[model samples]
Target: MEQAELPSPPSPARLPWDFHPALTEERLRLCGRMLANARRDALAMARYEMGDDPWSVGCRAFAFGRNRLQRAASSGDYPWLEVLDDSAHFVFVIGGNGNGVPVRFYRGAADEPTERTLRRQEMEVQQLSLALGETEAEGLAFRLAVET
Candidate 1:
């Protein structure tokens, strides 16, 4: 008798709502630990060191995005910036091969918003930025659609 294959479990994006970059090395170490603990079948995982050459990071982001169900990922001059997607935001860490490679993470996405999407994740971007060490003063002020 042939057995049926199990469907993949729902992979909800897991945002690091409480991250804070301590010592730069410490931050990467923590990211590596997180990556080690992330779901084995994560949709994307890429390195994102601050100040890396944009082209290099973009290449890695492209590789990661290519594996996503939505095929979306990119970076500006800032490799350690953020990712954009349609519905939600998430972050994941990967690295720790002991070669001293700095860890990278899969920050969640933020795309054009809809009423429902805004209601759900309007403030998530801010929170994720904070978690990633954006100071209160550095956080961007987002005006609601009605306010703009």
Candidate 2:
């Protein structure tokens, strides 16, 4: 009997926010630890805030985003940065591994005002940046940080 062929891997999903160039090896390690330590606490906080209503769906979304970012940073395959706007919504700039493509990440709500969402968005961005070693203040922003 012939052996079966293995399935191909899925393509990486693109984020909806922009990225800067603050990603560094040292920062990635630091952020990884921080995210690893705080993930459970963060989830708990989300559950508390959203309760068991449909709004709780947002918490799951946040977790999905957070987990993706954490895994990408930990793998060192991609470099990224996170920024916080005045309202506190996060804007993430994710780059391709070795390639120079870029993608963004953020949350959206049609009914809510932007200001009300800033805090959570900003917190998410801050944690992601810390994990990737990138910061808005550094001004090392990049649409893509392709590894040569």
Q: What is the TM-score of each candidate against the true structure?
A: 0.20, 0.31
Q: Looking at candidate 2, what is the lDDT of residue 88?
A: 19
Give per-residue CA lDDT, model 1, range 17-79, as digits (tens).
222232244444433333333323232343345445645544444344333412212322323
Which ranges of candidate 2 are over 4 A from the true structure?
A: 1-52, 81-106, 109-113, 119-148
Candidate 2 per-residue lDDT over residues 1-114, each given as its tens digit: 999998999977533232434444454454444444444444555655445543564455545545655555556554443322222132343333332212233344323424
Off by over 4 Å in 1: 1-23, 37-88, 91-104, 107-121, 128-148
Error of 2 at 68 (Å): 0.7
- When superposed on Cα atoms, how far off is each prediction in RMSD? 20.7, 13.8
lDDT of each: 0.34, 0.40
Best by TM-score: 2
